[model samples]
Target: MSEHFEPPEGGNKKVALLIAVLALMLALAEIGGKQAENEAVAKNIEASNLWSFFQAKTIRSTTLSTAADAMEIDLAAATDAAMRERMQKRIDDWKKTVARYDSEPSTNEGRKELTVRAKAAEHERDNLKARNENFEIASGLLQIGIVVASASIITGVVILAFVGGGLGALALGFMGLAMFAPHLLF
Candidate 1:
């Protein structure tokens, strides 16, 4: 008597390839998620630092004064030929700097932290409204980055799942890392 065994229908090579793809995707997802979280946390820290910077000083006098000084050169009041030109140039320079400040990120990270800090400052006292507005204006770049990074991470996860490998485990590990980062970091 002779006995024989049949090979599985699906190619093991294909299955292995699929598994590899899944593993890669899972790794990507894990990395992306961690980066997104880290970026957000870093941004938050920078924002907090910015807020602290402003809080430590008198906002109305410092930032606004510098900005205003840059803005007002008394171009109309002509003391002399060179004075008018100098004043005009000064005014232009001030406008440029003020515009930059207006367009900068509140914290080094961007608006998410700035916005949160601003809202908190606003609810607490009237004096902070202006500062919050400043922070909000500065937050644009970081905000866009954060949004993009988070979206990419979410999309990566979806793709990892579709690849159907050991992603489920990887995702669980990622979540655990995310939850524990703060404690681990500090």
Candidate 2:
């Protein structure tokens, strides 16, 4: 006796279509992840630079303050009138410079201004990091979906295909949320 078998109707085609859709979703997720990663890196660099600037300003302010204090001590012990007069003038100039470093809007480069800028940059960096994390999660889910969908195509299991589709849909939702409001997820 001879036996013959016919492939299930439309099963292969359906699985192929599912796989194609999943592949597309995976591609989009990958792109979003890359973009988010780049943004996070750029924001981190900017925050780091702002912090460095703030540190430099703090150092300058501290040096000026120390100089003023030392001049005060020297002036108290000075015997020469001319030397005391010069020291007093230098102390006054140092005090003014220190005050300007604390809060000078005209220069917009004071310690106060630098602190504000550094804080703002850190906030932005944190937001970007959240977005990047969401994107990474989305990408991983999409990758899993693509692999599962491909397996379904190979094994001819319709249930596996549905599971893959569900994962893909979830990934798409995360990607959209990351693009719109990443802070909500965080």
Candidate 3:
């Protein structure tokens, strides 16, 4: 059998509107929250990869420097001109490599450049986390506002509807901050 229902003859339609508006805001907040969460995770992974690259470069440069220094000592003591020349050449090459590793601004993959990149990624991750937190808060408030507005329908209390509307507005304010001015402190 099919059931047919009807709205109460004197129900407050404003409560339904409040519930609908809050539900819409809740959906927006959920979308923003998920997007911020995904982006934050990506930025975190980028920062981690950059930092690992920086460490690898540092280790390589240090090992090269130690080898070059040892080669320099051997070069000074070598009696054969040919051996001394070869050792000197190797030392020079290692020095150039170390310098490049320390700061290859053009490629932006050197230790110094990697540090800057990693820090910027971390900053972006932190900002996204904060935005996600605001969105979560907005979602919670909007959900609660929807529930309260529904309750107003059952209780026929106009004040409850006003409270629900206020909560919805507050949630929207948080969503606004998350979307437009996330860096601003509440």
Report every candidate's CA lDDT: 0.45, 0.81, 0.90
The better candidate by TM-score, 2 or 3, is 3
Best prediction by lDDT? 3
TM-score of 3: 0.92
TM-scores, each model vs. reference: 0.32, 0.83, 0.92
- Sorted on lDDT, best first, the list reads 3, 2, 1
Evaluated at residue 146, the lDDT of candidate 1 is 35
Candidate 2: segments with Cα more than 4 A from true spot: 1-11, 78-82
lDDT of 1 by residue, 88-184 (tens): 6766765555454444465332333445565554443322222233223223322333333333334443333333433334443434444443223
- For candidate 2, lDDT tens digit of each residue in 1-186? 885443378876876787788778778777777787787788778778877877887788899999999989989999999999999999999989888878788877787887787788778777777777777888788788878877776776677888888998998888888888888889
> Candidate 2: what lDDT?
0.81
Residue 108 of model 1, lDDT score: 33
**Residue pairs in clash, model 2:** none
Q: Which structure is stronger by lDDT: 2 or 3?
A: 3
